[model samples]
Target: MIVFDLACQPAGHRFEGWFGSSEDFAAQKERGLVACPQCGSHDVEKAVMAPRVGRKGNQSGTRNATSPARTPVASEALPPEVAQAMQKLARMQGEALKNSRWVGDDFAEQSRAMHYGERERETIHGEATAEEAHALIDEGIEVAPLPFPVAPPDETN
Candidate 1:
């Protein structure tokens, strides 16, 4: 099995998919069978791959690196009202997170704690690995990923 990082053109949500071979990936893509799980977009393509060098202790120098593929959606293509709504949503989220604590990488844990009543519920936003977010969802915790990445607090200054 081969894993490919695929991105859907026209919202850039990156994801990984497996295929029988490179040809299989192409075939599926051509048929528009591949879709972005995040946005259900079919305009998918291989994401840019990064080069990696093997360490001295590693036996094989070759390594496969995959990155999350994002689906691109042209915001300009949307109706003005829809675009305005999206902008409003983004602005609302930004305003909400402004006074909220920036927990950095502790997003998942902190969210879980609040869900389980281990920590007091308060506005917060931070980073969470995709897997961690999935786990949180599975556990019935209410967590929503941010539409855009936020710089860590320490990195801002």
Candidate 2:
């Protein structure tokens, strides 16, 4: 997988996008499949990024006072309306998941079973690979990615 730093137009909300290749990113963008996770905008473009070079082993690990600081907080980086919308969306997702069953890695199988009437239909959520999701869709089974990543029930504190 390859990761690209992406920025949405107008809002300029920066995020990372992973694709199979650079051409894959281009194709997704052309097809309007590439969207900002924060604002759901399709007008996204690659953002400038510095090379990820490692420090020399002998170099000191201390930072100079003149060095740049970390990125701003989420609220500071986003417009008030956008931030509010995002918070609302997050709350909605949490509420939706409260009624959904965590099926873990059996997402694809459970989804297929339900689609073929082998299993009872109910609200379910879990993890699936991109290819698995595509295959499910190709077989006429409706599936959607969650707006936010969810930790497995077992992994929670």
Model number with the top TM-score? 2
Candidate 1 local lDDT, 108-149, one digit each (tens): 899988998998999888876667878989999887756544
Residue-wise lDDT of candidate 2 within 1-157, one digit each (tens)?
7889999997999998899999989866764578887777889999999765668999889877898978876533777887898799899999999999999889999999999999899999987777888899999999998765677999899
lDDT of each: 0.76, 0.85
- TM-score for every candidate vs. truth? 0.49, 0.60
**Clashing residue pairs in candidate 2, if any?**
none
Q: Where does the lowest 10-residue lDDT sum fall in candidate 2?
A: 71-80
Candidate 2: segments with Cα more than 4 A from true spot? 1-5, 9-39, 42-48, 61-77
The list of candidate 1 runs beyond 4 A from truth reads: 1-44, 47-83
Give the range of the ten consecutive residues with the poorest summed lDDT in model 1.
Answer: 60-69
Q: For model 1, what is the alpha-carbon lDDT of residue 44?
A: 86
lDDT of 1 at 85: 76
Cα-based lDDT at residue 83, candidate 2 = 80
* Model 2: lDDT of residue 113: 96
